[model samples]
Target: MFITKSINTFGSYLMLMGKVFARPERMRSFFKQYTKEMSQLGVDSIGIVLLISFFIGAVICIQIKLNIQTPWMPRFVTGYTTREIMLLEFSSSIMCLILAGKVGSNIASELGTMRVTQQIDALEIMGVNSANFLILPKIAALVTMIPFLVTFSIAAGIIGAYATGWFANVINPEDLTYGLQYSFTEWFVWCGIIKSLFFAFIIASVSSFYGYTVEGGSIEVGKSSTNAVVHSSILILFSDLILTQLLTE
Candidate 1:
């Protein structure tokens, strides 16, 4: 039953996506909405992403320094491990999950409230492409913003590791820099961007779907918001694994 339900939701979500991209009735209005969403979704999101990423990187460095048993193990291994983990996994996956809760819930609740308040009905009454007007801006904003956030996260994580290591006397500056630059692959950055794009799409689309399709009152709107976060997080995790496998090959 769960599988069937998921499949149905997936199909409906894709249909909704099609509507989201339909040609806008007024390009100027669409552009205005897009700009607003870009600010709300992207610029507003930087602080939290940076804060979490910096701390995680700092903690990882401290933990790495504490973990090695062998005196022979290079101290710089901390840099490599921290870099790989932050860039490949934490920044893309964990950050997106955080966003799934923060931005996702907000998106769902905002739309859900609009639905429950008959704002959506009013739009349709005016023959507006409500989905396009409401959802496209969000989708466009996220796609543009998430990759930028992930890139910023990677940089912030490395800086955090550097600062923590330097101040805590856990690892030397030379080793940290060497470790990050060691065996670095340009492809890793590409992979991170790819994951961020997919995650951005999933978070926005899933949240919007719940918000747009909500069926009832304030209580139902709240439930839809909860469902949006829960489902988007699950999908982000599941898709991360699939992306890792595919991208590695």
Candidate 2:
């Protein structure tokens, strides 16, 4: 029964996506919504991304310096490890996981509320492609802006690592800078951006699915929002594993 239900849900999700990708009736209106979504879903998220990544980067640097450093180990290892963690995982996969909670819940709740309020029904009555009108812009906006978010996260994390040197006297600033520059791989940055693109799609689409298909009233909307966050987080983790393997190997 579980397998059957899962398959059925997957099928429904695919069908909805088909509807979502249809050509828009009005390009002007679509572009307007697209811009709005870009601001709301992407721009609004930059602050939280920077804030979290900064602290995480500092913590990672401190932990590596204290716990991992050895008598024989180079001091630069802390900076190197911090850079690798930010570029390879935290900026991409972990950041999306955080966003899954923030942006995913917002999408689910907004759509769920619309569903319960019969706003979608009203669109259907007006001959609008409701799925495309509502979901496409969000998906597009997130996918376009996620690369920027990943870049910001990486920069903020690096700065935070350096902050440890300046504020806490944790390490020599010159050594940390050299470590960050040593053996740096440009592809790692691109890898993070690429992984984030996939994660962005998963978060936007999965959350929108739950929200768009919501049943019942306010209670159901709340449940759908919770489910959206949980499922999106799971999918992001699962995909992160696959993407990491493919990108790295």
Candidate 3:
């Protein structure tokens, strides 16, 4: 029964995507929506990303210095490890998981509310391709802006690592700098950006699916929002594993 239900849901999701990708009736309206989503979904998220990444970077550096570092281990290892973790996982996968809660829930609730309030139905009554009109801009905005988020996350994390050296005295600034620059592969950064793009799509599309398909009252809208966050988080993790393997190899 679980497998059957899963397959059915997947089929429905794919069918919805078919409608979502249809050509927009008015390019002007689509562009306007695209700009709005970019602001609402992407730009507004910058503060949280920077704040969280900074703290996580500091914590990761401190943890390594306290627990992982030893007499034999190089001091630069703390910075190097922090860099690798941020570039390879945190900025891309973990950050997206965090976003799945914030952004995903937002998307789901907005759509679910529309569903319950008959707003989407009203659009359909006006002969609008409601799915495309409503969802495509969000998908595009998220995909376009995720790379910038990943980049900002990396910078904030690195600065946080340095902050620990300045204020916390946990690690040497010189050693941390050396470690961050040590054996740096530019591809690791690109890998993170690439992974984030896919994660963004999963968050937007999956959340939109739950919201757009909602079939009940306000209570059901809440349920769909929760489901959107949970499902998007799961998909982000699963895809992260696959993407890491594919990109690294």
Estimate TM-scores for all models: 0.96, 0.99, 0.99
Off by over 4 Å in 1: none
| Error of model 2, residue 241, in angstroms | 0.8
Per residue, candidate 2 scores C-alpha lDDT tens digits across 1-249 of 999999999999999999999998899999999999999999999999999999999999899888898879987888898999999999999999999999999999999999999999999999999999999999999999999999999999999999999999988889899889989999999999999999999999999999999999999999999999999999999999999999999
Query: Candidate 3, residues 1-249: lDDT per residue as tens digits?
Result: 999999999999999999999999999999999999999999999999999999999999999989999999888899999999999999999999999998999999999999989999999999999999999999999999999999999999999999999999999999999999999999999999999999999999999999999998989999999999999999999998899999999
lDDT of 2 at 96: 98
**RMSD of candidates 1 onward, in order:** 1.2, 0.6, 0.5
TM-score of 3: 0.99
Q: What TM-score, to 2 decimals, does candidate 2 have?
A: 0.99
Report lDDT (Cα) of residue 18, candidate 2: 100
Tell me how far candidate 1 lies from the true structure as C-alpha RMSD in angstroms. Answer: 1.2
Error of 1 at 149 (Å): 0.3
Q: Would you give me the overall lDDT of model 3?
A: 0.96
In the range 1-249, model 1's lDDT, one tens digit per residue, is: 999998999999989999998998999998899899989988899999999999899889888878752479876688999999998898999999999999999999999999989999999999999999999999999999998999989988998999886788778889899999989988988899899899999999999999999998989999999999999999999999999999978
Question: Native-vs-model 2 lDDT?
Answer: 0.96
Q: Which of the two candidates, 2 or 3, achieves a greater lDDT against the reference?
A: 3
Candidate-wise lDDT, in order: 0.92, 0.96, 0.96
Lowest summed-lDDT stretch of 10 residues in model 3? 67-76
